[model samples]
Target: MAEQKQTVSTDDGLILAPADEKQNAVASELEGSGISSPAEYEDLPDPDIGKTDAERAALDKALLWKIDLWLIPWLSLLYLLSFLDRTNIGNAKVANLEKSIGMVGRDYNNALTIFFISYAGAEPLTNILLKHWSPRYFFTGIIILWGIIMTLMGTIENQAGLLACRWFLGLAEAGLFPGVNYYLSCWYRRQELGFRAALFFSAAAMAGSFGGLLAAAISKMDGIGGYEGWRWIFILEGLATVFVGCFCYWMVFDFPDTARFLTADEKLRAMRRLRADNQTRATEEKISRRYVFQAVKDWKTWVYAVQYMGVLCPLYSFSLFLPTILVGMGYKGNRAQLMSVPPYAAAAAMTIFIGWFADRTKWRGYSNMAVSLMGCVGFAMLLGSSTPGVQYVGTFLGAMGIYPCVPNTLTWASNNVEGSLKRGVMVGIVVGWGNMNGVVSSNIYMPQDKPRYLTGHGIVFAYMFTCLFGGTMVMHFMLKRENRLRKSGQRDHWIEGKNEQEIRDLGDVRPDFIYTT
Candidate 1:
């Protein structure tokens, strides 16, 4: 007699019976739903259902391309503008913004610190609203409001006005970075996300490069329209951001299932692919307090947040002070602005390459450690060398190292987490916590410590090394051990259910789910 084959059934009514038994079991399940037999089911031309592996892969590739075309450019543009607006004050400071606005003492640093306060505080609420409202409306509305605030920043005549504008700008912009991150997680699988995130985040590096060039060009616009060049920087960039926001209102996609561009079959295939990857779908699950609490309690969320904090301190300081640093190295005003561009351009290229490599290798943690170590070396060079040329090279090394690690850190947190609600909450917590370094960074490099900011460089160097060690230990020791336990048949207690949502609600703690380190 032949050995008996085991059978399994899924909550979705899919039957995993032997070839001969499969048809009958499937037919029996469908009979209750009015499909009388497997023959009739097979006769239906439902391209979305029952696809072969080759066909599924082909459709997934095509759908991903369409998603990339529709999503990445708009999001990248929006992020570029956000970063430019946030850091343009640095460019403006070089062009006499402080003198023009009568900012004195630590007012500039205070202005920078105030932005992060509102930004971090509003992050969780903004993420909740992003889910409640559609991404199209929520994201566009955010951009428009921040653009308005940024434009008003050009009109400020005093420190108080500038502070108010910066605070409101932070509030308006709080949702965008984390919102886009969570949105990407909904569309792409873990392996695909690193590159997609890099494409999205490279915009920030591009913004640093482009903002320099734009500031250089606009510096000539001084006294044009009775406005200073710094004023023109804010006014023009803000107005352009508003225009793009209005245009993207009609163009930006929401979740995959609700995206207007995808066909019925494509939408079905997209959701199916995502479900197959991690046994979860990006459906509009109820916003449960339990999900938020679960994400907060996850040790990986806090560890990754701490690692991100190390990256952000140097990144924020670099973006805000690169022009000033270059000027201090004996470059003239316009020369300093132009000089700031190269490091950021190099960073953009490195970020894209590293992102692609991380995805291909599926080693997010190791990739992050490598890049972060490069950042450590870069900072060490800055601290040890007083030569202007050597310090300039340090900036390039720092840029390439730090910027590439950002996308990996983000994807690491997003990849390991499960469920839309849990992932959303986790991303918001991680990003908001990580941004606390913005406050630390703003205060680290003061006017007294200018010309090299040696103290600042030392602090950032130590932090990068901390990030490397923390990430390696967690990945190699904690996550690896957990994977082993799961593979060895040690399972966490979980509730069994006939409903898919119930199982998905278990989130990352579900026994079958293995974290991507």
Candidate 2:
């Protein structure tokens, strides 16, 4: 059908007569899409831009709930195993690697530091490597690899053996977090991405909960012949990871269009729908060094990297020391391990609740800032509390705060960019670089710091607060920038398919896509 010319009033009140009707021709061409005035098109299907103002507002709310079910359990499960497998050593420290492996003063700390160093160094590179590999196969292979290494960790005859295993494990598992973040962006609308990120991230909380149980149970295996229970922790948990990773390899969906589960129409709608949500050329793969260079060139890449590194310092440190902290609370090794569960359970609940709230409100920065403050307050209370009950409360609050911010911030930056190349490359750079904080955090809490944990807690609180302030500032700035673009009498700028893929697919017609704050 030939297109008919129509005059539409811009958001700024300027009347736009599409100089060429072919422009946004895709919008006009789509059936049931209602190319008429925004008000008349109340039945349109795009989730990002609903028929009318009221409808668009409503769909934004629905997107939040739509994504919640899938994001929560999947991420939580993955992280639980990853976190447990990574830090079960602290529990093992109490179990007797100190004796069996001849771990002397500071040897354990060095072992952890090795994990973080390799973790940090390899993170940035994983983001890049994921682009060339199918995320399903890549994560699957690596996860299985780490699981095997972790199982081997159970047999360490010396600290050097333990150290060698950790370094390799670090290298193997570096890509999952960033890959998950980048993958989520493919499905949800921008307003809904933060909380989805939060939900996925809360697995850290479970690692604490289930991890403690696993440790307590394994510690009992002390002489089930000759091998210590700590050895069991690594073996059982590593085996679990191998299974889960393999399961994901067999079942994980890549994209809506390619998803074996979705119907043809569903794929079309999913693709078209997201195009409306993000006015960027983000469809399909186009990997190249030029694209990688372009991603590196963006200022937000550095900003995101900095933000991630800052929070991770506190997070990794806290994960490594929870057992010690509980021990400091006066519980025996077994009981302290059990007690670690509650705080993380609380964190899991908070992460889901906060993520839902962020999606419901269509506000990313507010959700993250609030969570960061929660971390700060939680950390503060933890530092001051000598009472066991009060310390548990403080730990709960801190977990709540730290679990969600990085995911939200990472999504926020990713949503701002157009194109799969920029998003993938930049997400990798920022995510990989940000994780470098694990290196800083791993060493911060020395065994000598014990009870008060003054130096470690103090520095962690300081860094988190900085991220809170910095993330909030950047969020608002982006908000203002988006508002300016939206009101610039550029209606075409916001339309679907005018973005990166459209520019690439149809032509270089990058409608005035605006970045959110």
The model with the greatest lDDT is: 1
- In model 2, where is the ten-residue run with the lowest total lDDT? 8-17
**Cα lDDT of all candidates, in order?**
0.81, 0.69
Could you tally the backbone clashes for each prediction?
Answer: 0, 9
TM-scores for every candidate against the unseen true structure: 0.89, 0.83
RMSD of each: 5.8, 6.3
Taking the tens digit of each residue's C-alpha lDDT, what string does model 2 give over 417-517?
76666676777777767667776677777878777677878888988888655756675676566545444544343444355334443211133344555
RMSD of 1: 5.8
The Cα error of candidate 2 at residue 405, in Å, is 1.3
> Once superposed on the true structure, which residue ranges of model 1 sit more than 4 Å away at CA?
1-53, 492-504
In candidate 1, which residue pairs clash?
Answer: none
Per-residue lDDT of 73-166 in model 1, one digit per residue for the tens?
9899999999999999999999999999888889999999999999988886667788889799999899999999999888888999999999
